[model samples]
Target chain A: MDQALDLSGNKMTDLGNGHAVIEYGSPWGRPIARWVPSWGEEKREVIERMRKHLVQRFGEDRGLRMAENSRNMIIFPNLVINDIMAITIRTFQPEAADRMTVNAWALGSRDEDPDLRKLRLFNFLEFLGPGGFATPDDQEALENCQRGYRNAREAAWNDISKGMPRVGPPKNDDEEQMRCFWREWRRRMSAAA
Target chain B: MNADAHLARAATASGQCTRAQVEEFLYEEAALLDEWRVEDWFAMFAEGATYEVPPTGDGDELDPAKSLFYIADDYVRLRERVARLLKKDAHSEYPRSRLRHIVSNVRITGFAAGIADVTCNFITYRTKRGVVDTYYGQHFYRIDCSVSPWKIKSKRSVLDMDQLYAGKLTIII
Candidate 1:
């Protein structure tokens, strides 16, 4: 527990570079089977807050993954918050869940282009000036960012559809949602390029 | 030989556990889950047994105290989760998702004393109301053979997705 807590402090601390690595394949490239942890202490407050909210929204299993990487770069396109909403929709309104999974999400308007979508995320994180997402705290910021992030996820996935491994999205119209990290991947490439 | 190989050799050397016996044990467990036999499934674990669903990655060390897990349940919490599932108001499961668990590639990785480590590949297809989602993973079991029909000391399921592809882990994996 202490080791995990300690390593939680070992963050990359460089979203300034605006680059994050997205890894989806097996660590050992095994054609079969997978195992995976808790956050260490450096971001104790942040992690705890994220954990509480996430645990309440999703069940314990899926929620723990988000808290485990609380201070780490947010995994692209798979926001834990969005998952909470999605799961709720799935439970209460299966039709809505289908629509949400189909016609749904992002941090931006559905109309935003890929480039603008990239800029929105870059700005959303720093959230420094007026009109920026200035929440009372990181916890709220984490919660509030879901809708926009979902929108951003949609836009980001759209840009790199060709580069990503093309699996069919849940709905044909929602074909923009790619299978993996490429969801937020090519933005880093294009933003850096 | 590698440590895992050593473990595998040790388990079979006692010759008390056959490959078929292990396979049968797994199938029986799967049937209980398929029937939504939550209490029976819970009963399959030893008193202090754990069910560890780690992050969706490969080969996580899976230390409960140190590593982050998706579902890290001690017996008490595990029972609570099972109880919640049985509740009529549990939305995620009230309508009840139909799940089919396919267990394949069974292997006896390690065994010592009364415990044996078995690994198997799993692909679970969950269908609820009309949406269908498929989850694939590997299960690593630390099983106690001292008991009749054996009991799970620990079950570590590692999913293949970097993110959980399913909306919720409402059902047993």
Candidate 2:
């Protein structure tokens, strides 16, 4: 569901940095620039926190558990980032050079919203494209980076499988909920009419 | 008139549309792209057409040498680009895209010897990931003498907005 704005509403200017605030003053007036001094810094910290929490929640033993046929290898590099959810390294056939697939997620928020617990998660599953797997030396390097995640925190999962096969197109669940509300509102209006 | 004027007049003797007609043709072409009619849009270009998207600077006619995205050599490359855009295999268009294109301020910058240079300003509305991304750019088109059929010999999309707002450059600018 796409968000539609009434073009005839208040005068709006696109600041180009994922933000647009409503202006009631003079359309020609130079409004104060919307500033988020702690935006980038806060995001960085939250990412770190999320990483720590995940490790503690999913211990090494349970985190790496998989189905017998999964043929998956998990590398928790010492320099692991919370922003990166999980990276699965797999091989297609015995002779094929090891192929790497990175499963990373970005946590962000909309403007004027500062709910860390309510952060939005965007997932990206990319086949790192033919090279750069965890070599024996690389495997040794990641062992140093596996710290435990902080446990007992709220968490939610969103599947960001846009543009990927068999994974239905990406959708904004919130937007769909909003659409349902509007549909219900219209139905009620017609009933009252 | 000098030798140049005589050559120009001789060239103009062949079939060619007026500036307004050329603009109308381009405008219709833009409409096809905006509506996501991929095959119909491809039919607009001439055989062996050259499409170029130069990495422009503050200056005009950005040097081809610095072009970020260039297809100066062949039409097959353009076809490949359009093919990838339409293909479901391209990860960039997983959800496909909803776009609205606005082309305006078209001007015939030059006309002589049956070769004309055309310019226009445009704005694009690219929507995906629940966001609407805006892009502004100027288009440069050079019609060749061999373009008796009034086909576009060359097309250069010189964008004013450099930041790629969308996830990828899957659609034509």
Candidate 2 lDDT score at position A173: 24
What is the C-alpha lDDT profile of model 2 across B1-173, one tens digit per residue? Answer: 99667546544643463556766778788788878777777766778887765433443555433322322324665666666567655545545778888888776667767767777898888786566767678888877645544667778776675443332344577
Chain B TM-score, all predictions listed:
0.89, 0.77
Residue range A1-193, candidate 2, lDDT tens digits: 1134221222223322222222221111110111123234546554545444444576433322210001111121211222122222232222222223333222232352334322221011111111111122232233222211122143332333333342442222213322333445567678899
* lDDT (Cα, tens digit) per residue for candidate 1, span A1-193: 3234331222222122232322122121110011121212433454355456676787555454443432212234434222110111011122441232211122234654443333333323222111112211232233234444567655643343442353532222222333234524666678788
Candidate 1, which segments miss by more than 4 Å at Cα? Answer: A1-193, B1-11
The second chain of candidate 2 has a TM-score of: 0.77
Interface DockQ of each model: 0.01, 0.01
What lDDT score is found at residue A21 in candidate 1? Answer: 24
Scored against the true structure, residue B50 in model 2 reaches a CA lDDT of 71
Classified by CAPRI criteria, candidate 1 counts as: incorrect
